[model samples]
Target chain A: EDQVTQSPEALRLQEGESSSLNCSYTVSGLRGLFWYRQDPGKGPEFLFTLYSAGEEKEKERLKATLTKKESFLHITAPKPEDSATYLCAVQAYGDVTSYDKVIFGPGTSLSVIP
Target chain B: DAMVIQNPRYQVTQFGKPVTLSCSQTLNHNVMYWYQQKSSQAPKLLFHYYDKDFNNEADTPDNFQSRRPNTSFCFLDIRSPGLGDAAMYLCATSRGRTSHNEQFFGPGTRLTVL
Candidate 1:
């Protein structure tokens, strides 16, 4: 079965702290890995998509790196605005004629205290 | 900006009552998805529409039904609401079934069953 797991269910850090969240997956054929940031009472916002191992993507203060079995979302000098639930998802290659399956992990909730 | 949009940011319905939630997208994407997200849990795929074709997840209950009237609009109909069915219903859209395509989500609808 394809599964995605995220560690450190909740994290609290002071403003300007740096931290990393982990996402591990088991799938038949890895097609894509996605990262999203969701604020409370709202939907997730798309962050990055990594397609292969060793692939990395970065935004202003967030960087995502992918590996064969895991991915890491590193936050650099995270501010209070960066406090949100970070979600990791994986898409697997399924039967071509069938719908591709995307599995999501229980998100890691991060809090930045000012 | 091209984006996904959902109606009724919050909904309340009585148990066993039928409810319908609507979503529309301006991205002109060919694929649309509906997911159920409970508090502190990952979003679970209920179904998706690839153009005019509907694909339902095997685990999805029969009470959950969806309709795609056109490229930009889709609706999720719950025939009978249960207390357990209270959750956030998220709508998402993607261009196509490409490994690199990132799904864009709308502000979800929070459903409260009473």
Candidate 2:
């Protein structure tokens, strides 16, 4: 069975603190990895898509990096506005002829206190 | 700006009653997805529509059904609501049926089953 596990279920940081969230997966074949940020009472917002190892993408103070077995979302100098749940999902190579289903991890809840 | 829209941010339905949640996307994306999210958990994929074709998750309940009447609108119908079925239903859209693309999501509809 394909499974995605995220570590540090919750993280609390003061303003200007930097940290990283981890997501590890066990799947047959990885097609893509995704990162999203969801605020309370709102749907998730797309952050980045990493297709291969050693790839990275950045937006504002967030950076996402991928490796063979895991992906990391690093936040630099996070502010109170950055408080939200960070989700990581993996798209595996499932049945052919159709795109694989995207499976999500439990997510990391981050709180940036000012 | 083009965006995905979900109607009735909060919905209240009685047990054994049927309820419908509506979603519309102005992005004209070829693929739309429905996800169910419980508190503090990752959103789970219930089903998705690629064009007019419907794809359901193997573990999804038969009580849940979906209809995509056109390219822009989709609805989720819960035949008989139960207390366990109360959660937030999210609507998302992608440009196509590709694994590399990021999905855009609406604010979501929170359902309360009494």
Model 1 per-residue lDDT tens digits across residues A23-60? 99999989899999999999999999999999999999
lDDT of 2 by residue, B1-114 (tens): 999999989999999999999999999999999999999998999999999999998899999999999999999999999999999999999986665357899999999999
Question: What is the overall TM-score of model 2 with all chains considered together?
Answer: 0.97
TM-score of each: 0.98, 0.97
**Which segments of candidate 1 are over 4 A away from where they belong?**
none
lDDT of 1 by residue, B4-114 (tens): 999999999999999999999999999999999999999999999989989999999999999999999999999999999999999999988665358899999999999
**lDDT of prediction 2:** 0.94
lDDT of 2 at A15: 100
Give the docking tier of candidate 2: high
Distance from true location, Cα of A17 in model 1, Å = 1.4
Each model's number of backbone clashes?
Answer: 0, 0
